[model samples]
Target: MAEPVADQNSALPDSPPDGQGEATEPTNANREAAKYRTKLREAEAKLEATEKRVNALLRAQVESLAAKELSVASDIFDIGGASIDDLTDPEGNVMSDAVDAAVKALLAKRPGLRNGSAPWGDVGGGRRGSIPDAPPTMLEALKFTRR
Candidate 1:
């Protein structure tokens, strides 16, 4: 009968280097992992808070631009179901061209939101009738006295 040979695959597991035991190695590794996980969580939380602030600032900028250029209320954007992303580029910067396009689209969809100013020059309260060529009353005669 042939003698059985020890295979490399069946050999004993290697021991930790430098006389360190396996138990202490795992504990140290776990502690480092836990520390890293805690730091990651904190960083993620700060990132989330920063993103919220950025979105708020971007929204404010959109509203202010809409009010100034479109002469419309901030609600106009909401009415169109448009979000901040629609008004911004990939870099999160507001694009004036995009804003104009969005406003145009909204105006087209809702004509009532047109930037019609207050009844400016003359709505009605001005002169009523045409001036009489022949000076009907004495008040008209005062014009000749001043000349």
Candidate 2:
């Protein structure tokens, strides 16, 4: 028996219908939306980096201002729980008046934070005695005896 011939006018199983094939091509709206999404992501990342830099600068300014009046600025940052925003204005500029007020308030509350105030006694060798005029011999050194 002979095999039957396939018809040329019939649609193939692997190919989509003629009118529906246009859907496979991307539309201008889709391309524009993708472009905007990429731009948005880049903008968000840049904003985050800028915020980190601004916060670091503000923190340094706060510490420098505090250091001028106090021996330990970390004590104020740690104990007072102060934020960088507290020392800076809405425009991200350091507010010297606010910083001065904060330092004064902290010093009033913690008198010890003031500069030139020693927390402990002077650190030195405890009552060191004068050494002998002559150097000891190796044998005397090995003896471990004190003058």
Candidate 3:
């Protein structure tokens, strides 16, 4: 069959020549909404992080209380296995290292309670000699004044 000739009589719609359609510029309202959405996302992320930190702190507190109760009930505290100082939050507050606290408690009732010196075996050589229970730090030594 012979192909029919196409119709050229109808006019095309009076619109912009479609290359790519016109890029719509964002309105001020659209820009403001986008800004608010970004801010909301940031706020959500910040809230999530804060919640995690708060949960950690609460868990630590619960653990601390449990440890104190266990120590006291087991006579560890009474027998100087853990001191009141150990049960408390230490200065500068490393959040409750239970093992460290317990060890401090155990060592609390030492020669310092009496007028006795520490066992020489605490230092090297295990020989019978008295040493200061706590040696001075480097900072303390540096402060020495010898005229």
Alpha-carbon local distance difference test for all models:
0.78, 0.80, 0.54
Model 1 TM-score on a 0 to 1 scale:
0.63
Q: Give stretches of model 3 more than 4 Å off.
A: 1-26, 69-147
Model 1, residue pairs in steric clash: none
Off by over 4 Å in 1: 1-20, 69-72, 114-119, 126-147
Better of 1 and 2 by TM-score: 1
Two-way lDDT contest, 1 vs 2, winner: 2
Residue range 1-147, candidate 3, lDDT tens digits: 989886674454444555433333356558899999999999999999997886566545544543443433334444545444454454524345664455355546442332133244544555576687999998778789542
* Number of the top-ranking candidate, with TM-score as the measure: 1
| Poorest 10 consecutive residues by lDDT, candidate 3 | 110-119
* Model 2 C-alpha lDDT per residue in residues 1-147, reported as the tens digit of each score: 989877875654555766355465566569988999999999999999999997887888788888887888766578666777787888879888888888888888988878775466757847767788899999999789655
RMSD of 3: 17.2
Error of 3 at 112 (Å): 33
Residue 36 Cα positional deviation in candidate 1, in Å, after optimal superposition: 0.6
Q: Which residue ranges in model 2 land beyond 4 Å of their true spot?
A: 1-22, 25-28, 117-147
